[model samples]
Target: MKLAIVAVGHRQPDWISAGCSEYLKRLPPEMAARMIEIKPEPRGSKSREQLLAAERSRIDAALPASVRLIVLDEKGDDLTTLKLAGRLEQWQADGRDAALLIGGADGLDPALKARAAEKIRLSSLTLPHGLARLLLCEQLYRAVSVLKNHPYHREG
Candidate 1:
C-alpha cells in the first residue's frame, strides 16, 4: 500500500531531511512511503484565522483524491507500535493508501480535522514541526518492519 506523509512547511533542517530520506529509501518497494511537504502561507502580521485558513487550503490541495486522510494531532488516539502495524496491514488489505497529515505551528484546522477518517498522536509533549516529520517517518518504518518480520522493531 502507498503511504504519504503530508506535512506543512518547507526548508527544514538538514537532519530532518536526512532522517526522513533514510526511511523512505529503506521502505519496501511494494509498500511505498513518501513525504509531501505542504508550504505554509507567508507569515507576517496576518490574523490567526487567516493563517489557519491558508494553511488548511494548502494541505487540502496536496492530498490525493484516492487516499484516506489521517490527521496527526495531540488529541488523537495513541496506539502501540504493534497496533499501528496492524492498522497499516488492514489498510493495505483494504487496498487504500494512507495519507498522514501533520499540521503547522498553530495546529490543525477544525475543518481539516473534521474530514479525517482517523487521527493519531505521536506524543503528549509538543515537538517542532520539522522534528515531528522525522519522528513520524521513523515510526512508520519501524511499524512496517515489524509487520514484515524485520529485526528493526523490538517489543518489551
Candidate 2:
C-alpha cells in the first residue's frame, strides 16, 4: 500500500525537512510515505476565494484517482493516536493507496473537504503549514510503529 501527503506551500525551513525526514526514514518499506508539495498561489492582492480555488485545482491535480482521500482541517475529526493507528492499519491491510491532503494558509476549499473520505485534525491550535507537515509525518511513523508492535508509542 502507498501513502502520500499532498500539501500546499513550500520553501520550508531546513528544520522542517529534517524533522519530517527523520520519521519518514523510519517507516518500513511497504508503508513509506511520499511528500508531494503543491506550489501556493501567489498571495499578491488575490481574494481568499481566488487563492483557495487555485490551490484546490493544484491539490486535485496532485491526487491519485480512486484512492482514499483524507483532508487535514481544524474542523476535521480529532482522532487519538491509537485511533489513527487503527485506521492506518485498516488502510494498509486493504492494499490501497491513501492520500492525506494538507491545505494552504487560507485552509481547504469546501469542495475539497466534501470530497474527503475522512477528515482529520492534527491539533486544535493553528499550526504553520510546515509544522503540520512535520507532525503528520511523525504521527504516521508512530502509527506504523504501533501497528508493528514497536515500542515507539507508550500509553498511560
How much lDDT does each candidate structure score? Answer: 0.87, 0.89
User: Which parts of model 1 have CA positions greater than 4 angstroms off?
Assistant: none
Q: What is the clash count for each candidate, in the order shown? A: 0, 0
Cα lDDT tens digits for candidate 2, 1-156: 788999888678999988988988899999878889999999999999899999999988888878899999888899988999999988887778999999888888888888888989999998888999999999999988888899999989
Q: TM per model?
A: 0.94, 0.94
lDDT of 1 by residue, 20-63 (tens): 99988899987888999888877799987788899998887878
lDDT of 2 at 65: 77
